[model samples]
Target: MNWLGWLHDFFTDPAHRSGPDSVLNRLLEHLAFSAEALALAALIALPLGLLIGYWGRGMFLVTALTGVARALPTLGLVTLTVLLAGVGDAAVLVPLTALAVPPLLVAAAEGVRGTDPDTRDAARGIGLTHPQTLFQVCVPAALPTLLAGFRTAAVQVIATATVAAYVGQGGLGRYVIDGLATRNFATTAGGALLVVLLAVAVQLLFSLLIRYASPRGARTGLVDDPAGSPALLKESV
Candidate 1:
């Protein structure tokens, strides 16, 4: 089939359309796997990162360990996990979670560490407790950077989740693998394109969510004015 006809068929073929076990269904499943793994990793990594980065304790050790985790190749890690856990989603989950942790940890830690000392001191000066300072002052300040880390982890997981098919877990990767087995280039290309589109959509959605959740001052890069301070135009006049 010509490229244009292939595109039309991909979109219009009733069997290929969104349904149980359809391309869209597989894409959603892949996304679900990515989300669940990353969410679990975030729950674990975020608090640990906050403690290490904000308190400046065990930062070195945690950072070092995460670096080592990140250094392990995704394929190698997945293979090892399959060897131990046996094939299926468990095998894929182990490696994707491992791949996700490093970015989350590093971003959270760096975000906390990167908070301005003056701002932190000001929060302390207000008689806030250590936890309050970390949560209210430091975390809000570092949200953008932390979100960037999340974006990175999310995209990586989505792309890598396709590897699940190699271990007998069905995903969009099934189409690719099956295509290759039957020498069907069209199916392989279609599946690959769907994966790419899904990844892009997820990235864009998360980026927008991060921006929306960021504080107005942070999003605009404007410093907070003290109460009773004149408005900028009034002060200028």
Candidate 2:
């Protein structure tokens, strides 16, 4: 059948539409896989990133690791992981975590490095402990950049999670793979569309979350409000 006919059949076919292995189930499975992978990756990468960035030590090793991580292709990593860890969900998590680390680590390092020296000195002068300075001061300052990195990682994980289906893990990608196996163009196209939609939705959610968590100053880009004075009053009034 032609593309249009296939799409019509896909939507209208009762047999295809009414089952446990339907499109909706596959999409939900895909979302679950992506979310779990991203959450796990964030839990692992974020703390390590914060430590490496905030403490200003281990920068070299962290950078090197992140660089190596970035260089590894998702497919290749997944292949190796499957060989070592065997198939199933474990195979998916290994590569997804690897995919997530670089952006998180870089963001963290940059966030810590970008923190103003004066602010650090001021915190130190107040006799704040290193951990206090890190959590209370440096992290707050670096939040915007860090959030940007987090968003990047989230999007990356979602896109790559489809690979899990290739190894017999259930996801929307099953549609695409199954379609190819059976020469069903509609399933493949529909699956690809679903993956794109999933990525966009995840990205939007994360962007909103970052904005909600960001400091007012970071969101507004005005570190401090202008002083009230006659000249300023004249300009406004």
Off by over 4 Å in 2: 1-8, 13-18, 215-237
Relative to the true structure, candidate 1 has a C-alpha RMSD (angstroms) of 7.3
Question: Clashing residue pairs in candidate 2, if any?
Answer: none
- Across 1-237, the per-residue lDDT of candidate 2 in tens digits comes to 777777776666665565756777777787788777767777887788788777778888876887788889888888888898888788888888888877777777777777889999999999999989989999888776676676777778878888887899888788788888998888777777778888898767766666665655455432111111111111110
Worst lDDT 10-window in candidate 1: 228-237
Best by lDDT: 1
For residues 157-188, could you state the per-residue lDDT of candidate 1 as single tens digits? 88888887788777888777777888776777
What is each predicted model's overall lDDT from 0 to 1?
A: 0.76, 0.74
Against the true structure, what is each candidate's TM-score?
Answer: 0.84, 0.82
Clashes of 1: 0
